[model samples]
Target chain A: MPPDAPAHLSEEQIISLVAYLAGGAGGDLAVGIGDDCAVLGGDQTGLVVTTDLLVQGSHFDLELMSPADVGHRSMAANLSDLAAMGARPAYGFLSLGMPARPTAAFVSELVGSMVAQGRAHGLKLAGGDTVKAPQVVINLCLLGAMGNLAPVLRSGGRLGDAVCVTGLLGGSGAGLAWLQAGRDPAEAAAAEAVAAHCRPTPRVAAGRALAESGRVHAMMDLSDGLAADLPRLARASGLGAAVEAEAVPISPAALAVAPALGGDALGWALGGGEDFELLFTCDPGEVPLLAQVVAEAAEGLTVTQVGRLTQGPGVTLIKQGEEEPITYKGFDHFQEPAP
Target chain B: MPPDAPAHLSEEQIISLVAYLAGGAGGDLAVGIGDDCAVLGGDQTGLVVTTDLLVQGSHFDLELMSPADVGHRSMAANLSDLAAMGARPAYGFLSLGMPARPTAAFVSELVGSMVAQGRAHGLKLAGGDTVKAPQVVINLCLLGAMGNLAPVLRSGGRLGDAVCVTGLLGGSGAGLAWLQAGRDPAEAAAAEAVAAHCRPTPRVAAGRALAESGRVHAMMDLSDGLAADLPRLARASGLGAAVEAEAVPISPAALAVAPALGGDALGWALGGGEDFELLFTCDPGEVPLLAQVVAEAAEGLTVTQVGRLTQGPGVTLIKQGEEEPITYKGFDHFQEPAP
Candidate 1:
């Protein structure tokens, strides 16, 4: 336990504590803890399973988002986990905790949005359980099938692997910041950020293409910003990473809001979360092949090489002529606001 | 929608609404909405999935049960769903919502109890997500596998199938009543009820035996009493049922507490929920073989024949010489209190 491991531990600390308590001795599971999804029965066709929770106030504020947006975002979060593993989305089970005496329209809208998203991703909502609570709680469990290949894992990167990210970063974080500032959503620059924050498109096609290329060695979705998540990938693979500050892609929306918040655009690009983009590692020689695979997928996505895995441990950043260690901190639920 | 459907719909009504919204047109699902677990594929080895939720005040009262008991019961609820499908328990994912600043001890206790139960039933706690909320909310998703046989579903019963229940009923409900009455747990009868309510066992071995014997046609866990759940099984199979009032298995603990609550033991036995016992349908001619199979499981569990499926549209209760249609009411979360 860390010095701050008390009643109000960070989300990462609590998850680590649980991982320790639940031991990594899964009998038939290929990958258990420290991965995006648990791999069950590692045959030609492996099953990858993941679960996510979206709570009222903590995950979404009803005042800011509609029920449909909440439903869609919750589905996207879980589907992104499957996409990280390069699995074909198959089945979904939802357990919803609703407020007492919720209206029929409320229930219908929530379920309809979830079903529509499921159909878009080829996932069928097969079963679910519901209960009345003080607020809305959406817990979705998704299952995906790995067809004729091993599901990609976070711990598969090598020392010489090139670190890359799919799509731009900082859009969702910028959107959240704009919303929190009580700004007009109709503002030209804020529109993109708000839309990205409300409805993130999971990089399913990009992830599948990367996984099928047989070049990508390790992969994971960026739910918790590149600065916080890249170190996790490094630690999992027992290596280190050196990210070039200039190479990190910053969205135009984030750039527009950076001056108003008195923060740099690059900071948001590195630390802002909920991007739902893929951060992966591959052999330096396979960059062109990986790009070709993404082109064939017709998703019009850009894969940017941001860093390289090193033989050392932990993550470092090269900004201008200075080199500094990157700290592991992001959008933790229990983390205190940084001044 | 029913005439009574409105803002304050009952739990069953809400579930029906969700099912309608989700739709039952599962392309590759062997069993979908109206079954204990959703069967993923119809091959020799099929995956069965189920999800359940335990809200703080709605599902369990902290004053009545310990954290460990709450954790144990939540796992039991999902395991029972897998048991109903005659599937081998495989993997589990738990998503927990905790109070904003919960004690470390509280989190540890809850997770420890869940992990212990998972190990006992050969289930591996693979992955999960946690969020902060107003109260503790537990949502568990379980996966099971049926080997070398098709998963038994609630729609498999025919008109001539006999309705049977494994183990006794009404114990958990009686236990809950005892606790709510502020009774002492030290009392012998109350102790049994309290134990049953706190740690109801899922009949996995019995379920496997019945499925292996190829005698059981339809099955589901009695989460919502015989009067309510039997109709569900019947409706799913496009059949009706006739239950004998005298044949319903009432526990001694329930009988002890019934008089104090101004109700009969049979009433508790008929209307109780959270029993976690298997209510299944089998061919009348195969009842003897099913009993023998249960005996071989060696838990000394009794398989009681309480009713039979009929070629009609609804359930009928045969009491003395009179017959009455059973009402579709049980422990609905949004239901009004009985006067």
Candidate 2:
């Protein structure tokens, strides 16, 4: 085992391997690896827990994001995992790594924002740890209660299940692109795009409705866009996925800002990350009713079908009345995962 | 507020303020701040959770600690918090910030040790997330079951309660000192000190027994030694404390190595942190029976009474028949507390 031996696996594969090696779901662990949150206590009625960490440079740009925005987004990223499982936010433990010379005001604002964000969804901050580090780091472990509803897992999808998405997509991706280019924030659509990137809402109600409807077979939050996230869902369910190019729900902000930014809306819709929307698979016969259920549950936020789960070895895109193989590059923490 | 304005608050005060502002124990939160672990669901039943984060440069010396040692200590530290509350380990979520270009072997050893350590206490790794970081950062969130036993809190001590401690003290602190002094590990008393520093056994059974005896008032693991941790316990209980210097349990290893290292075993025993023993307050009437119960429960370990909780404004150390008010300058993350 040379120290420089390059790992040949992808990030997803590496995570799966880690999960597999770490031991999968067992007694009292209803679902473990390859799920939005680990289901503990029971299958349908127990606790769901998720943990996430965000670094300063890798996760956000300080030039554009205020301390409050950083805290808010960190909370949003973790809560979305709970939303994917339709778990009610309960309590959170936040561990912070502050810079060595951190000012008291900065530390106070950063923590205050996280507490406020947790309060928005009825989650309380119970306890935490703070240590000095080179840069600001936050790790949040959230526990949610799963009362009387089966946590919709990524592995439950069946072949031919209609693939649906909540709200629009790519605004967050387009927003980051716009901001990274140092574009004017006062310009038309810039504020919307920036806000989308900084504070995307988690689709909690929509996910809960889908789970309660008993029509959805699988569900996951679209943090990594469809390109990266769809394959995960399909792979977890032991199926494949297909996306209709024209049917993809591109955000109005992305559509409006893409031309000025010299980007492609459809590409962003397909591959852009940080959308914070819900992606799901449901019985095709109940698509209309499920859409209605989601809209009614989430205050007129419509969930539209983009494609279907299929019996295949990989994901494909249907465009111009022809299906073509697609492997859209997406953000992965690892350049190449360990085998 | 100016960003650079000096904030006159200590780290502990800052933490307490945050907890107070965030919200104290309410609803299902049995105990919020000032406790080893946050008790959730009910007072005597349900769960307890604790979170801790360890950074490479600040918390550990990579030169002295292998990846496996790092993993082991990280798990041990979090589990000690559970022991203080008399909770049985259940599951854990480990979030990692892996350095870019990490060796596969290093990653394997690090993760494997953590999983193995969790299994020692019947805790399983449920799920986790990883992002690239400049240095290795490990954050573990552990949950344990209360199982119809009341969680011992730092705020439970009463006036005139006898203060007690489990096992020996100062071995870990002395071990760290010896290693930092560049002493040979093969020398006399060095191996024991190094092992004590690397993998201190948590007093899980002792804590459980003390809780079961129903005579223990307040309890906490001695992570920060008597000088630092005792004040915290006293403040939490809204009382003062007195420690008899002669009665402080000094580890044989610390005593043996102190002369050669030109250090005072008494000072190390008082100010030295990371002892991982349980410091508790109990009813004086049950001292004899409590000691027997602890000995029986924890496999012949002795629990010795050292002092008493008092009705006063501060802690005092009684040395050689002289009572002196002592702050002792224990380990505080902040240089000075903020006002």
- lDDT winner: 1
Error of 2 at A75 (Å): 0.8
**Candidate 2 lDDT over residue span B306-337, tens digit each:** 89999966899999999998677656555533
lDDT of candidate 1 over B1-339, digit per residue (tens): 334557666687788888887887456876677689888762213778899988888888888888889989999988999989888888889898876555666767788888888788878888898877777889999988787667888988898889999889998889888888888877875788888899889888888778887878899989988888999999989999999998998988788777766656776678878889999998888887787788778378888999899997999999996899997487667655321
Per-prediction TM-score, please?
Answer: 0.94, 0.95
lDDT per residue (tens digit) for residues A1-339 in model 1:
233567656677688777877887455877776789988863213788899888788888887777888888888888899999998888889999887677887887778888888878888888888888778989999988877778999999999899999888998888888888878877886888888888888877778878888888999999989999999899899999999998898888888877776756787789888899999999988877787777677367788889899986879998996889997486666554321
TM-score of 2: 0.95
CA-only RMSD, every prediction: 2.8, 3.2
Q: In model 2, how large is the Cα lDDT of residue B189?
A: 71
TM-score of the A chain in model 1: 0.93
